[model samples]
Every structure is written in C-alpha cells, then in structure tokens.
Target: MRILLSILLVLLFVPDWSGEPRLPLLPDAAAFRVEQVVLDRRDPARTKLGGLTYLGGVELHGPGPAFGGFSAMMVEGERFTLLSDGGNIVSFVMGGDWTPRAVRFAALPAGPGRGWHKRERDSESLTRDPATGQLWVGFERANEIWRYAPGFAAAQAHSAPPAMVKWSSNGGAEAMVRLRDGRFVVLAEDRRGSVKGTVRGLAFNSDPVKAPRHGFTFSYRPSRGFKPTDMAELPDGRIAILNRRFAVSSAFTAALTLVPRAAIRPGAVVTGREIARFESPVRHDNFEALAVVREGRDTILWIASDDNQWPAQRSLLLKFRLDI
Candidate 1:
C-alpha cells in the first residue's frame, strides 16, 4: 500500500504537537561549543576600538539544528541568554576562561503563531526589565511583542500595537530597551512615515502590552543605508545603538552610536553621534545583539553576531570596555 507507507513515514519523522507540554526541552550536554578568536589576525592580541578597549572574543559552534541565528541577547554577569531568529533560546554560563558551562537550550513556550514555519517564529529583538526580571521579545513577521515570565517559564502577555502594524514583514521591531526611568523604547528596522533615512520609534510609559495605546512616536537616524540592530543603555542614562550594513563584496560592517538622554523627547527626531566603526582588518560579521554591564568604574560592552545558519559564516561573540 503506497498510501500506507507515506503515512508511516510522516509519523516517524514528525514530532507530535497535539499534547506538547508548556515546558522547554533540554538540549544535550555536548550540544554547544566555543573557540577563542582574535579580532585582528595580524596582531592576534589587539583590536581597533575607536573609543573602547578590546577584551576578548570567541567563535561559537554547535552540532544542534537550532544552534545559530542568535539575533538578540541578555547578560547577567557570567550567565548569558541568547535568542535565535528561529525562536529558540540558548542559555549558558561562561567562566573567565571563555568556556561555556551549564548550557541549556529550549524553544519559546509560546510564540506569535503555531511555530509551523520560520517566518512564524522570526524573533528579532529582546529586552529585559531589571527590577521585575521580566523579558520582552519582538517578533518580525507578526510585528508583535511578547512578554515572558522570569526564567522564560511562560508567556504572560503579548501585543500587536497599531503603530507597528505597517512595518515591513522582515523589518519590524529590531531593537528595544527598557530605560532606567521605567520607559520602554522600540525602534523599527526599516524607514516609515515618509522618512527616507529615518526609522520609526515608539516610547511607552509602562508595560508595552498593558499600555499599548499609550505611547508616543519618534524617529531614529542610523548611518546611511544602515538599519538599527540593537541598543543598550549606559549607566549615565545615555544609549548606545548598533547599526549594520551588508554588501556583496565587503560582506558586513557595523557602527556604534551614542545618543544623549536629553535628545529622546517625544515627537522629535534623534540622531546618535558615531562613536566606533567596524571595517576591514577588524573581524566583523552580522553583529546584531548588544548588552552593557557596569563593573565599578568600568563599562563593559558585549556584542554577538548572527551567522544566519550559513556554513560560510561563523558565530562571533565579542567583549569591549567603553572608555567613556
């Protein structure tokens, strides 16, 4: 029976989702690995940082199917939580030696759709509230934001704000940050509202989902032809934004800009001052994720790149100390 054989094959290869539980699945102990790499091949110990100092970096690799595509990240001391574009979550602890330990991998307990296709789960941005430990994720295709409980145990709420409904399918919310003053800022990856080089931004007073209708509009200007990828707030209330550009020959390049707090007023267009640029002689890729941590008098910056799950590209994680 040809029909019977086809049915059997489908049952053997497809995972059962009818009774799937709400908890995340644990990955194998040896699923993830990391190898150190120098930012500059010539020196191997020094890197070009316009206003920062390079600490170290590594190339991440794994044998699992959903290992790469990390577009956003959250860091708490030595613990790191990364979210992939495929809607998978990878969390691990890295010691001073750059070795990853206690690695755990899982899928989002809930997403915008049924997780049937890659577009249905194209999560692009992430932000966390330090006071509450709550996490917020931005999905690109659906153009919505979902809030997860601490530890990502469950999805508590989600929203598809009217302002973000018109964003491009693949260019929806790409960067987000919860400011220290309890305000939330979200930046679109593409230009909107008749603006050529400017992207749309939204600021919320409280939780985005709860106060979805209570927000104001603003504009963000990235480098020409570049798009905002990620943002992190500094200890002194300024914000740093990462913008990326891709070309056929040059592959990829990135820029870091700093925005003053006073320039973030509602209904205003804000442009950040370029602080650093990544180009040739400096190892760079699709650097999309950013996070900042303060250690006494030093400001530590962490950046991660998305390999796009391609063989030719490598996942990169870099650290630098901002010199103010």
Candidate 2:
C-alpha cells in the first residue's frame, strides 16, 4: 500500500514525462547573446567557434569507450572542465596571449565508472567546492551523489538526503552548487507532482554523510513550454537559469536571468515571474551546464548542451555577454 500510494502521489503532481498542458514561452529579454553552436563530434585538434574566445580544445580517450553526448561545463578563470553524460571528463587551459589562438586543450581522466556503485549511474551535473576544490557529481537513475578529489583520482559516494531517496528516482538530484558560506545547494529533479524541480540548499559541516535543513526551493516553468536545464549565480547574487525544450517542443531555446538571490529559500514560494527570460535565435538541446566568466569589466555567460548520443544533435558551447 505504501508503494502504491507513493506512485500515485508522483503521478498526480510530477510533470509528466509525457506532454501535458504546455506553459507558454514568456516574452524575450535582451541580457544574453548566443554567439555560436559547434556541431563537430570528432575528437578535434581544435574546436573553434566563429566569434567567441577560444576556451581551449579537448580530446578524450578511454579504455572501453570515450564519453559522448557532451553536456555541461564549469570554468574558473582561464581553466575550464567539461562533463559528458557518457561519463567522460575534459580539461583545458587558456593561453596567455589573450587571442582566440592562444588557448590549448588537454584531456583529463574519465569520471567514476557506472558499475562502481549500485545505482544506474549517469552523470548529469558538476560543481566544484570553492575551498576544497573537490568536485561533486550528481547521478541520475540510481539517485546518488559522489565527491571526487581533484583530477578524478578517487571518489567517495555519500548517502543522499532522506527525503530525496524516499521519493525514489523522480526526486534524484539534477544540479549542485556550493554557497559562499560553504554549504552546498542541490536541485531536485521533481517533487510533489510538479515539473518544478526542488532546490535544496544544505550546509556541509565536518560530516559529509547527511544533509540537514532545507536551504531554498524553486520550480521550473517553460515559456511557450520549455523546461529549465541548469542554473548559475552571478557575482552580485542574481541567478541565471538555462532552459531547454522537451517533448513536442524539445528543441526550443531560452533562458531566465536577474533572479534575486534573496528569493530562493526553503519553503519559500516563488514563480517564473521573478525570472527574466533570454531569447536566442538558435535551437538548443539539454542545455545542461552554465558558468560565469569575468574578463576585466565584462562578465560572459557560458552555456553547453547534452547531445544525447543523437547524430542530429551537436555538442554545443555558447557564450553570452551579460548586459547587467
């Protein structure tokens, strides 16, 4: 009876993977610019876009299979890392000359293997702990969290929040980011029968096993029926959210910016209204990663997509100059 009840509860509120009442796309704002989407899948000597700064190029190798379907990315200054759902890691270093020509790419070790744990493992989101430089990875299907030391040399899995595991795979984490205070914030894929994924802001004390107390919560809404992919906090504390299309309109492209940091909290209620959406002229798929890079006075927003192993899809990295 308990299992049946839980399934019923999820069906009632969780955003149907099947198409349902679609949310209309909100009016477009002007805070972002999508410079280019690179479609080449080959291990390139150099992957260069038309107008953006070269972030370096990477070629990945593996014992069994190299990770494909490249998705999200995280950048700190001249250094950046890329995550592929196929479970591969790539790293790059920027050149000192400061032109697009100066950057160089280097491949890093592969992420922890799928069979390493009991869960049905697939990497979704990646975030670096600011102080420790540890990388936290969110896994789908099996619904687990793993922390890896620098260079993916060793990893330790953590028990998830009790509420999250009880909710089953539907409540598995989607994205994670470390707070200024050293606590980590996690995004739940779905909760209480709404497509709105839950944001969990938790503090990591000396112990890493348990997550206590709710930090913040936010749900996603599709403008003209789009789903949010990932989020990043700006220097001033506002959030920039990446959105992608699913189901009938799964190829739409848009984003939301200017979300005040004060608005995201536990048990706090907020909607897409606090979000200002970005309108781009290109189509996007599973725009699963985002990072903010500042060069002097200008702050650039970096966006990447998960190709889902489809030939029609492209491993795309796009750059936008923030007007705010």
Candidate 3:
C-alpha cells in the first residue's frame, strides 16, 4: 500500500516527458528533432474531426529558436518536407513504424536579398511539379514568385507580378497550388475578394513566375471570418484549401474546404464548400501548411502549423485520412 501511494504521488507531480510543452531551443538555426504527440491531449482515443480521421502527428522541437514558423509542406511517399516562412527547411522520412530517418536540415539555396533577413525570405506558399521535381515558392513582403531547380538546388528564376505589387507586403501569396492540368492557382492572404466573404485569387494558364500575366482573376469564398492560408490539388483535380481564423479569445481554428476544378477560370467566382472543421475538441493551431497525397484508394492530407517561434505555441505536423 505504501509503494502504491508513492507511485501515485510521482505520477501526479512529475510531468510526462512526452507531454510537457517546450519551445524550440534555437529559433534561427536549421537544426531540430521530431517527436510524436497525441492528436488531442484532452481526448486520446478521439479521432474523428468532421470528415478527417486522425492518422498521426508530430511536434518538432529544436534549440531555443529558428525551428518553427513552418508554413508550407510537401509529402512525397514517406518523405516529408516542411518549409518555414523564414526560408528554413526540414525534411525527414517516417515509415510504417513511425520512426524518423534520413533527417536533414537545410535552407533555401538562394533567395531574395541573399536571404539575410526573415522578411526577405517570407516564403508563405510552395508547389512542385511531380514530373520534373521543380518547385515554386511564393515570397510575401516582396510579392514575388521564385522557381527553383529540383531539390531546391538552385534558384532558376523569379518575378514580381505587377498584379501583386499592391498587395499587403505581409499578406501576399499565402496559398498556391499547381494543378494536374498544367495550370497554377495563387491566392492572396489579405486582398479582399470581389465578394465580401471571399478572397482574391488568380488562375494562371502557364507557370506563374514565368507568365504572371497569363492568368485571370478569381475569388474564393471561405467560411465566415476565416482566411484561406494554404491550398493543394486533390487527386481528382479538385482544389483543397485550408481556412484559418484566430482571435484572442478563440485561439486558432481552421476549416477544410473544397472548390471544383471547373470553377477556377477567367473571371470566375468560386466557392469553397466546408468539408471539415478543426476547433474546440480537436487539434488546432496556427495551421498554415497543407498537402494532399494518395495511398491506394485513400486520399491523405498533411497539415502543419506555424508556431511563429513563440514558446507558447508549437510546431505541429498532422496527418489525416481524407474521407470526403
């Protein structure tokens, strides 16, 4: 009986090594580690979140700084690459056993102004061509889109579209996606849409950075008070967009919405129908990265959060089974 009481006392007072929240030790460096975290600390067995089924998730940690702020993601097979707004990159492979392997820490080989400052490399959006491995990154503040060679080995080209010049420096190009049909879609983070509840978007017939003038204007209406933060092309050619909303009292909340591929065209006004919600009972954060992949017949969704290098928040990477 005495031993039992002692064990209970320790359990009550000692924090679970895995559950204790810790900030990135190094916020401005490219080194970090990944640890598995529960989907919901409040409800470990709960998995359903609207139309998504929780597959798994991880919390990335690093020395005091330079680790979080991840705003874009790419999931190819078992490899995961997360890109931060400040130009840092983290890549790793997690296999069926959920063990991370081949971990690599790197930064964009080259970017605006030599990437000397965080604002100079505020890469808020990313997209890739599966066939060529070429990548496109949208940098806010500069309102420019840069194309990189496969593996981000080199910056091939960049252009600041006149259309984007007037957008809010910190609110430009928050979401971008390359469709399977050889087109691209770019959405502004703050530019108001033609409609009250929508945001401004553009559809490019060719590479956006190469032919920024070739696309037409469009609009995307998200859930009320939410702004589209990131987007990905679904396997069926539809568009999957992530809508985020946060206030002091509400914290962070997100809505998963979809737009028909056909609705993205010249002078088109598209609406994203809400398919899922991430709030109260489920895992939620300052989610700004989103990616879609396919496994057999199941469609997969990977979402990440930008902790903004704050100790109170966390850099989260979550995987979900997209049923709808």
> Model 2 TM-score?
0.66
lDDT of 2 at 101: 26
| Residue lDDT tens for model 1, 1-324 | 999897787668755433334222335654677899887887787865798788898899977556888899999999999898888888889867999988888888888877756677888999998888999999998999999999899999999988899889989989998898888889998846335678998888887888887888889888776789999899999999999999998888999999987787788888878888887788878999999997778999999999988888888989999987
- Could you give the candidate ranking by TM-score, starting with the highest? 1, 3, 2
Model 3 residue runs over 4 Å out of place are 1-31
Q: Which runs of model 2 end up more than 4 angstroms from their true locations? A: 1-67, 94-119, 166-171, 192-224, 247-252, 272-280
Candidate 1 — which residues are off by over 4 angstroms?
A: 4-27
Worst 10 residues of 1 by lDDT: 17-26
TM-score pick, better of 1 and 3 = 1
Models 1 onward score TM values of 0.92, 0.66, 0.89
lDDT of 1: 0.85
Candidate-wise lDDT, in order = 0.85, 0.52, 0.86
Lowest summed lDDT over 10 consecutive residues: which window, candidate 3? 17-26
The digit string of per-residue lDDT tens for model 2 on 144-165 reads 5677777566775555554456
Better of 1 and 2 by TM-score: 1
